[model samples]
Target: MSETQMPAGQLSGNVLFYSKPEPLAKELHSKIGVKRMDGPFKFAKVGHAIPLTVGEFPLAAVTGPIIFVGDEKLPIAVMGLNAGENMFVKDDGTFESGIYIPAYVRRYPFVFANDEQNNQMVLCIDRNAEFIVDKGYDMAFFEANGEPTEYTKNCIEFCNNFEVERQRTVSFVQILKDLDLFETKEATFTPANPDGTQGETQKIAEYFGVSEEKLNALPAAKFVELRDNGALGQIYAHMHSLVGWDRMIALALTKAAAQQPQAANA
Candidate 1:
């Protein structure tokens, strides 16, 4: 995935949130290190949803809706009602306390690239990350001896574990595919009329999800198989996460009201 140098303006993968990713090498980046950032997660505001591994469903479900995308069929946690607006992210680029943040967001600026020639995964970093600096900073990528520093080692471990989780997520998706469990799903909201009646329903979102009807229809043996394989729990988590759509609608209403023009005193 990496080479002696990643040509200027060239990026290797389609990984989300990475810009100008380059392979980490002591020869090319010995002076480069990470510094403390003022608005660390501001970059995340560009996306309304963040990808999630199946392992994160239960924890992430409590915070927001987790649904599968059409193209990738991978689960993502929806954070905002509109595109390019991550409601969970503050204007200062910080996530609020006591909320579950996706690993995909926290692992920013670092990702793994496949080294095809060497048949291995190599560490890469977004060359344009605001936190990365040259010399005497918060943490160095490598020591002068051409070995990874403690901080770099920790980052490598985290990335490796994430890859393992990601692969496991793929297997989980395949299992669901085999069971024919996914179905198209939509979310909607209805406003209260001026008097008391409910207003017309409006479509809020459309995505794929594990259909409870299909899940219930599985043969006893097949149901047992899913339960034994630890997928049933994840399925329930996904289903439960749908409730978060209400939370999103509420937040969206609040945000919309804030953006409305105030009437001057009559």
Candidate 2:
């Protein structure tokens, strides 16, 4: 299906990472130039969650909670447990040092849009991006000869690679779904009170994750199929990523306390 034809419930709209995705064409190339991203990550401040391609699971698992979203089971690295807050992003707009940045976020300002009529994907960019420049910039989308530059070509290649990984992730999630191994789960956190006592437990978020029980119950034949298909490692990575939930809770409690100092002091 074309991106525009994606269902409202899907995360394809302006809400899914990119703010405004417009096809990059020769007609628009003259008006577009991108400055080197010199400062912190200004583009990432808009959203707390970043999408994850299947290949990023192992590295992302070490950085944050990796979970699936919506019916499509799109993988995402949870940067923050609460809305409008990202623990990984510092005040300077850069991610925390040494943390893994998902390719979906790194591919920011550029993406591949589905060309439904042609049944293919086209390269697109966010015109509203701050790094876009009209003139006096070393970076240019196209040369004076009207050919795409190395920078634009590199972006296309990156987007293409991400698209390939995204498709693989779709198949991975489908396998889990078909096996009925996914289950809904909620994470609760209880912070220590100012008096040095345990406080009330609060449910932080709800999400879908793999069920170990169901996976273990799978027939030996099915298990062999997953192993032979090279999906077993990914499944194990996802399950192991759940260990980051505790880290998320710790970060959330710190943010909560910082937001409500009075309660924290009480």
Candidate 3:
């Protein structure tokens, strides 16, 4: 998507999202602290994505820099729309069906008034720069130290849970974690097949849009497995564009060599 296709005015604001800071909130404040703030944080209210417009154009919206309800000091990228809905409540002012209410309901803080109906966590960023896109996921946090940490096991398990080919099954968040695994030195492995020649491995590498050498260098076998399963294409595409086509190709070859097993049977 091009900048021109985005809404006319540059969005330059933020919003915070969480169950209210009350003890009665369904989402626990303490648990949020334990789970490392990570990516592929899709804009979900009821485990579903929210779609809205900024300056009159449509885009996927999600929460970013998620904070405990009480921490309002940090910048918030509030969605331009409020899609929260009313939950069935008990006499004591608590929800009856174990569902949670959103803070952005009613006179929604988001730019869109309709957004308040579904309890969706739609956030507004100043630009596309705030978001890191994936096939269907949106990134949520940026690590000040550097690139975010990888969740390799979570990514692999998530893919296997779907039973689809990795290309089709993996979401944007899964790929981000997988790549993080590589950057953080958690992954190692490369391609293997009936043909022993590394040249034969070039297709999967190209499918990832990386090169033969890069596909052979990853430290994690699962990364190769994902490549072999066709999960690396979109990642390769994005990285290639972000880092330059040639540089990304070289990086891929190097990573594949570093991560793949050297002793695979031909």
Highest-lDDT candidate: 1
Residue 178, model 2: Cα distance from true site in angstroms = 1.0
RMSD of each: 2.7, 4.3, 23.0
User: TM-score, each model?
Assistant: 0.91, 0.87, 0.20
Clashes in each model (backbone N, CA, C under 3 Å)? 2, 0, 57
lDDT measured at residue 56 in model 2 versus the true structure, 0 to 100: 87
Residue 200 miss distance in model 3 (angstroms):
43
Clashing pairs in 1: 1-114, 1-115
Candidate 3 C-alpha lDDT tens digits along 40-104? 12223322112211111111111211111111111112221123421122323333342322322
Q: By the lDDT metric, which is better: model 2 or model 3?
A: 2
lDDT of 2 at 38: 55
TM-score of 1: 0.91
Task: Mark the regions of model 2 whose C-alpha exceeds 4 Å error after superposition.
Answer: 1-12, 117-119, 255-266
- The best candidate by TM-score is 1
Worst 10 residues of 3 by lDDT: 52-61
